[model samples]
Target: MSASSRDRKFPLAIEALALSEAAAPFSLRLGQGEALSLLSEDAQSLSLFCDVLAGFASPTCGKIFIDGQDITSEPPEHRAIVLVSPRDPVFGHLDVAANIALALRAKGAAAQLIDATVKKTLALVGLDAQNGHRADLLTPEQAARLKLARALAGAPSVLVLDGLLNELDLRAASKTRDLVTRLQRALGLTLIHAASSREDALWLGGRIALLDRHALIQCADAATLMERPSDARSASLFGEANLLTGRVLEIEDDVARIHLACGGVVEAMADAELAVDALCILCIRPDRMTPLFGALAAGDDETPPLVATIQSVLHTGEHIRFRLRLADGGEIEMRRPLLQPMRGVTQGALLQLAWQASQAVAFPMKDDL
Candidate 1:
């Protein structure tokens, strides 16, 4: 390879990698030395996508690239891509250290090198003290970490994980996530993680490719997806987003004034092309919504607070989630912290809901929504 080719930032690019004939071809670029997460509600699709990346499954019509080289048809042995998944098997006959060393050895790594890498990876995954322990005797957390250690021992070009952390408890998963992130940064490894939930995707923290069922919905940063979702489906994936159908009343720069189908007119930030009187789907996060107290803040009278009765409240320690029934009988949700609870946030209490225009996003109305 030329010096320039070796030094250039080589992104892992996937162009139209379709899992099935009906599943929309998945495409994304995991930038050099950073992590990217494929988020989806479908576990099977996520696994298939990761399998394609790991060269274990064939794409109907697509190409995969690593270090600017097409690896579309490369077999697992030649791809230099490793996958860690819940279904990954452990060699019960092999000891902890031997399990990790096996992959490096397969790559024809020197004995000294394999031994060194195995020891270092064990420490990195917090399994250094268990190097001689039988792999079958490991706890769930240890087994998960061992999987990571084994994958890292080979020093893969791209590491693809299929909800590997989801196999552990909440606390263990959080810790393992942090460890994986640190390892990736320290090694300058290209990481692509598959997550079944938005929280998992958000925690992974690079770029997010959201897949609904099997189709690629949108690929962007967490803030972009949250505050400026491409559609109602994307918005709903995030926390408790309140979506209401509406029509564009006017366009003011990047923000659009919308008249709701339910009964209010509110302003929302429009990141997409929107013309006057166009159909719109308004998205506002429950956390961004507030209950109006005393006199309402002066703004747009057409966007007056909608009167609603709190139907139920769920306290999640950090925040209180409320289910409210609007005047038109439509339900809208509001979530707020306990430190600053609304004056009448209790169940059956009447309240006026308000939210800032900047906190809302407007997407073009679609039948899928």
Candidate 2:
């Protein structure tokens, strides 16, 4: 289905949001109760986007609409958006309960209501045990949770989390992501999580919006974005990809057979039409390419195989990475689980590699290149 149709199904919670900085203008739309992982490696850019969403910064162009209401010009207090930044402040002198209740007090909530809300928010975030402890005495994880609790005190419609999971270890990050997902569903909140790495965005497990040079590059689910990226930049965002320049030789249904400049023929699933002899690029993940042992297996596999000499091997804890040089001097990398048996696989060893057509993506070559 088209993006417009998908957007219609999920009503807009945040629409036409744009922010301008020194680099370029970025714009995006978020659906209700949907979690969007904004991918950007630049800390400043991430901060600017969050600030704009939280009304801490103003956009030079575009408007922000929430629940069909224009809130572009509204102040932070009235936008019903909560921002939990990595640098979120806390009152060192105050206790956990008091810090969580600060927003309620600012909104002129009654003392009794503030206390009730504070208790509930603390318990909801699993921080009730530290209610009476000073804010400064809390650990980094606990402090971060307190900040989230404070943000939730107002029951904001949209939650903007800026690199909250960036500094966390893998296990902790997973737990935090799960907690955020649970809270989003329970509270019916629209969550916008900013991540600096592709793994972090994928770990969040929803829609991902890739931002580069202050521009929104691509927005799609993890699998779709990896399989059918719009451009080289988008394709490279998901880690190392085996990209080769080639020319379309023929088209059969949804597959396009291409002859690579590096001296190999490959077939890839094509999502767009391409003229014969047209230059294009074939992209496939290293892990998708399987290494064939000994002679070609006696099977119905029709994928063209290439022989390469293993140039280097790197052990990466759970996996082993091999750098190989093909007969035509083209270099490629492949990764396999360390647990996988490799009887004769070693540096300087000849290995055959092949991948199915459906596992590769083909994109037309750009004129600029």
Candidate 3:
């Protein structure tokens, strides 16, 4: 550990504990100095979750543990978790450095200690040169770093960022994210950042906790979450997924014979709970489907190739996307890297695609067949 790290408090761990019940009570565990990105479509939901974690709001019923101690009932200041949000109020009367000293002053910190800490933190967040600037005069990115520096000045065990990035422009948010991630690792600061998009969560590099409608859906690293999302809702949220309704025709080990509602029979990997005649939702990511320009592989006893009519092909410089229509008149999209050639394929052409049975997973649908 560096000298500064040794002088500061050791990094802390937090665990939001919940029983594995019907409500799926929203459990998350972060190791000491670990970072996590909490992603959700609902801004209010994210704020509420952060509120509960930071002790601004009490849970209806649950326990929140910090470093193995139950801190659910602790107030915001007592819990040692600091929350930084774009909506957090600033002191217009104070300059950048004084604004950061608010929390330090609140605790009756020594003037000398506060000065040294403020100088170090200002440099850490790259705001050292702007210590005298008025709060209102700072750019969006500078304002963001100011908030982070102030939060750090409080010496909180875990930092909760709620929709802070969404407050800035795209370029500014990207730069702020990179800077924060670097500061987080450098200081071994445990962080819980609420992200606005999948790209944001992935770029931040941490365990990702997904939420929808105020309910925590799934928690995993980016790759693991994308590969085996708990449900179709999660799969679609992580990336573009062609969700098709299907039924299990038969089962051979982990793979299932699926008869699609859109008029095709194929095989998909299934969990042990799936049985014959069960209604299922099959999710196929666009990039997972390969375009076959040569001889078609249409029929087989195992999983067969899928056929679609190319409605249009779009090249977005970075990648190629194909809009295809299925036999049942339903449409789906397929994306391929720019390196993949069209090979003379044109609009209204037959786009035969193949994929591994594992590439497309069929999740059990709640709807009765």
Candidate 4:
């Protein structure tokens, strides 16, 4: 089924949007009040995506519908979709209030209406526009907020933010994300946020659209995308996942026992049909694998533990990252909370690592890898 046909029942704010430059075509759909984080590391592709969405550049082919209306040929102004960037064109000489009013004035809004709208927008974004601070003097956070205020002044149903949150540190980014999400909910606006990293995408807390090679590779929430990626590339993009090669030893109900190349057997949740001895890949997040410091206690489950030697340990503020080498010479990484007791763990120390059967995912092995 086509992407557009699958989402017919909902009132879409953006639909069947496809674009192309020198590589594969790009396509996506966004429903009203829904947020989509477009994940792309390449700055050029991200810029082009925003440009086409804002009507700054025409797509080589395909249509763009906003609010169920075809606005593929309409200029940016007529689409009720606003694009706000960190470096958005703002009149540096003008004060915050004037900058906020500029777009409304250009649209021929009444002077009183512009004043009222600008006042409300600035307040909504937590900015004191009456202070008359010049645009050139605003801090990065303030400036970003101003840009959002300006976009809101236009009363758009859709907001396209281009790398605006990428400039801030984690703390500031979290605050900005919260503010944007609240605004999106309060205003009933569809948001298309361009994110540069997996952390940023996860922090944005929305369905993510992974854009690679000028194509929409995958679209899903953070958990689904990380746990059940469509391919190896998508899995790698999530970062810090142990993608291990294994052969199916047996299948019982929804669980499959697999023999890992790393010299251990593990049971994983199996969603796909696999015959005995079929080669596949297992995806397990580092945090999901726990280290059993010593031998198992009496009456413990019969599942054998995975034994490995700790290769290295790094102390991150919140967790300790361990690099371990398996008996078969393969390596894997694991993360343990800082509060977890680390009694006998050290470099070159032998340890038993185990994880729940439901925590692992299996997929058909890709030939490229």
Candidate 5:
């Protein structure tokens, strides 16, 4: 089936492509310093290349295309692709100007234009005043910004950023990423930013493609990915929630009525013929479910209720998560808090949790079905 372009197109007419991976292991760090030295050392002069845009250890095996043209066999420079990674691609001994110039030179740019482009790009990153300083003498954040500037200096059609913002604190990372995204929009550049977290991807306003077990399983916009994920793995990667296996117990107003293994019943939006012998999993976001403070309220008189005990309450800035233990020994989390303290329920209080039938989902419970 042909996927919709609703995802691949942007206001600036740039076409961004995303791919998946297969059997990829999560890399646990052994020595932080050792890993840093290797990545930084390999990126000495800001010259970098990757054949496949987004893949795991099999760049050549993955198909790549730019502007709707297949460029899997083309050189990185010819493809107008620049990659800025975790290890800043700056020259330690060379000044920032020279570092930026090297990138332009790699693309066979004229020397005269290099100086002007370097100044402009550096200014965009708030580092124009430090163009004369050696890259090694600059602070970690400064070096990172310079590498991003150098990558943008060439005015590539596509920019790939990987792991550069993960090291920063939340505030700084948020600001820097916003700046990069603004630049991308202004320059009409297609940006493919890869990060290990969905929070980062959401901040960049970029679509997410989950890679698990070296396979491309799910790709969609931030809202779609979170709301209607293709499978359980994709759902977990987006953010852990309640994925409960259940059977259909009732259907109401185009909603599938599911009964969980723990004898709890809930309603989810579904089509016809999903009742008998239909084994499915229900997806509920932690923040969406709420603890049952009392018996059926007047407004949501028809909403299904799941009785649970408060296992824990987590204060998460904008909301408080009430981790609850459901009647069947399973766990369900509900989030509350839109200013002011929540009433009635203490940390260990028992309450009935209720949610709208439309908020939940029922799908096949298989991992690779």
Candidate 6:
């Protein structure tokens, strides 16, 4: 009935209807004007539930599909999927081994089957030594680890991890991601991970899909999506992007020279176009814009012409981020090795901004939809 539903008939990894949500007894209808007030309250609650279910809303009025198979009529049980909800509680009395067994048993698994799954999942979660410890007695980290193992023991074709990682500490989160990555690869599983953190989504390399107000807006591979989102919602969701308001002043070989409203001329490859009155936002990734070195004295190939001043440096374990201010007051982020000599690139001191022509990505930006 909706444009999105029709568009999805083509081909997709997953598809949903005009999925909506609201509080009970709200009595709202999209076709009726009387439901306008109720729409606001219902929309937020429905959106939250959809997010918790990894983009599945309750009482789906339309067909659903996965990998070209119609799964709308099937209950969650027959879908070869494992869904962990916020309401799902961990048993405080059971130990790690017992917890795994209990979950599989509840799914109607035989005793022998449950035992084997528990052992394999426990080993997967690095709980070989803590298998005997009571689940209540284990630390929060261990308990959380068990929860993942329980969900994974079934070896479901699809793993729908909602916000479980949000509750874990950095170390615990990193450990969980590593294990999930290994399992996903080993089992050839399709993972639909939902997170508010852009970094988390980016790290789970695959396709990145952006959902805005219950509608799937944009989806693309990690690198391509981050570097160039289809619109504003996607551009912002792809982590750090510089949204510059400008128009095409000139077009060169595969590049367009843009004149920013702030009176600065910048150049990026011309991927799309806009009329004289059509406003556009240029989405540029900070990492793509590296600090260019000056011209090499005698045939030095690495020196670049654009100059910049380092405003601050954020030291990450594997990478160091240098926040630089361009000569025109615009800022960009550059990531380099932690051990690299960036100490001398102090704040207010000038440095060159250089990047290959292929690194920059251009996207057509629109207002929030």
RMSD of each: 3.4, 4.6, 5.0, 4.3, 8.5, 9.4
Better of 3 and 5 by lDDT: 3
> Lowest-scoring 10 consecutive residues by lDDT in candidate 6?
31-40
Put down candidate 5 lDDT per residue, 1-369, tens digits, no spaces: 222243233211212222233333221111110111111112221122222442222341434545444555666556655677764457899998899888678768787888789878888889978979999899767877887888888776567677677667777777787787777666666666665555655665545555554444566666877777776666666755577788876666778877777655677765343454578777777766755574543334343456677888778788777778876787776777766356766766767655687676667656563
Which whole-number lDDT from 0 to 100 does residue 368 have in model 6? 52
Residue 107 lDDT (model 1): 75
Say which prediction, candidate 1 or candidate 2, comes out ahead on TM-score.
1
Model 4: weakest 10-residue lDDT segment is: 296-305
| Residue-by-residue lDDT tens digits, candidate 6, 1-369 | 654454333222234454554211111111110001101112344334334233344544444444345555676656655665454557878777887888677778898888888888888878889988888787666776777788788775556665566567889888877877786666656566665656666666666556556555565666666666666556655646666666666666767666655444566666665433345566566666655443422322332245567788888888888877766787767787766675456666767654454555444545452
Please, what is the whole-model Cα lDDT of each candidate in the order they appear? 0.81, 0.77, 0.80, 0.77, 0.61, 0.59
Q: Which is the leading candidate under lDDT?
A: 1
Task: Give the runs in model 3 whose Cα sits over 4 Å from its true position.
Answer: 1-23, 292-305, 343-349, 367-369
Q: How many steric overlaps are in each model, in order?
A: 0, 0, 0, 0, 10, 7
On a 0 to 100 scale, what is the lDDT of residue 91 in model 4?
A: 74
Per-residue lDDT of candidate 1, residues 1-369 (tens digit): 752354335667777777788777766676678888887767888898888888888988978887777888989888878999877877888999999988778778999998899889999899988999999999878998999999987778889888687768988887888888888888888888898787778776788888876788888999888766777788887544888888898988788988887766778898576678889888889889878745545546666556678799888998888888876789988888898745655677776666778898888887677
Which clashing pairs does model 3 show? Answer: none
lDDT of 3 by residue, 1-369 (tens): 542333233244333433223334655567768898988877787788888888877665667766666678888878788999866866767899999988898889999999998999999999988999899888888988999999999877789998777668989987998898898889888999888778878876888988876677788898888898888878877765888888899888788879888766877788657778988988889899878765666577554556788899899998998899988899999999988876767887886766778898888886421
lDDT of 1 at 221: 90
Query: Which has the higher lDDT value, candidate number 1 or candidate number 6?
Result: 1
After aligning candidate 4 to the native by TM-score, how far in Å is the CA of 311 from where it should be?
2.8
Q: What is the lDDT of residue 61 in candidate 6?
A: 47
